[model samples]
Target: MNDKPLSGRKAQAARNDKLILEAAREVFVADPEAPIAEVAKLAGVGISALYRRYPSKEDLLRKLCGDGLARYTELVREALESEGDLWGAFREFLRKVVVADTPSITVRLAGTFTPTSDMFEAAVAADELNRALLARVKDAGVLREDVENGDLALVTESVSSISLGDAERTRELRLRALELYLEALRAPGAGPLPSSAPSEEEMGARWVPKQAK
Candidate 1:
């Protein structure tokens, strides 16, 4: 891998690439169906620049979701190997999830684009890690008995709705919301939940592009 600093046109291209990915995250993460032109406009780069980098809207979406999934799986793998109490590890995992802000990726843009095989594999691996963490917490008797694999996703997904148009403040608000949910999870002798957890199959269906179906 070359570490040499890029100069002139190459340097500017790198900068534009960064802007495009960041703007894409902000734009498509908010509205999966938003046009690619929106990403270019928000990125402050011309449509030609974005097309040169991503070629197509689906290409950009796959890149964004793939990045999100990779980060999430990495965190989950770390949590599995973490020390200290099980509850603490689970709490840390939830906190990291908020910081990663990945629930929105799976919740919002899932079915809008076709996923590659690599993306599907990562999703499966992340799911296995999540179930392991939940199982450990359940056995420790801290988490509510009714909580299920899919329930955890919903708990985190709820925080995705807290957008104050400011990153720092939005994170703070989301953390506060997580605390409330944590308290609810610890409810003593909680009654049975109203429904069963969603299976991976049901969730996977959303990853299939609408046109593919």
Candidate 2:
């Protein structure tokens, strides 16, 4: 019962917890209902270890969701503070969602899980940041005047829906699609867009969709 052996056990446990959490994030991104056994296998840990760290799938889901939201919020904050022009920052934000963070899967899953006020607030804060960014771009006479925060959200959703072969191909095509959409959104000769965008309230209510839920 040497003290060094006990210290090693604690260090190993910490490493196992980190591995399990990382694996769980990747698994949930692929499919939110991916089995804990799969996550354990990916983490190279025993099933018992996953449970020892998480207790239940719900527990693991909550942690993953929280971590995702925090990460997304930070991304938003960074985009806002980016030194580039507002439009570049806005484009980067879209990239971060659809191409960077896997379409905000954590935020998407938050709705499917037991309700949490923290996640809700985080979503709202992110939306507000988007709103401010939209305003800045509009004031600079860059974005089409008709464009609203909801319109930008819709554009991101539309691009996220596109499927193009493998992940690399999908990213390439998505970026091209985004570029086209961004061109359409730019002012100058922008034509009248179709029906008005959904209100922020409507967006919040309908963001995930029944099919996804």
Best by lDDT: 1
Q: In model 1, state the lDDT of residue 98.
A: 94
Candidate 1 clashing pairs, residues 3+ apart or interchain: none
Candidate 1 residue-wise lDDT at 117: 88
Q: Find the candidate with the highest TM-score and give its number.
A: 1
Candidate 2 stretches greater than 4 Å from native? 1-18, 102-110, 206-213
Poorest 10 consecutive residues by lDDT, candidate 2:
102-111
Kindly report which residue stretches of model 1 are placed more than 4 angstroms away from their true locations once superposed: 1-11, 187-189
Tens digit of per-residue lDDT, candidate 1, span 46-76: 9998999999998998998998998988888
Candidate 2 to native Cα RMSD, angstroms: 5.0
Q: lDDT scores for all predictions?
A: 0.86, 0.74
lDDT for each residue of candidate 2 in 1-213, tens digit (9 for 90 to 100)? 556544788899999988998898778766776788999999999999889889988688777777766776677777777775877887777777766654545334544456367767877887787777777778878778898877776677677667669879988888889899888888864478789988967767643435566
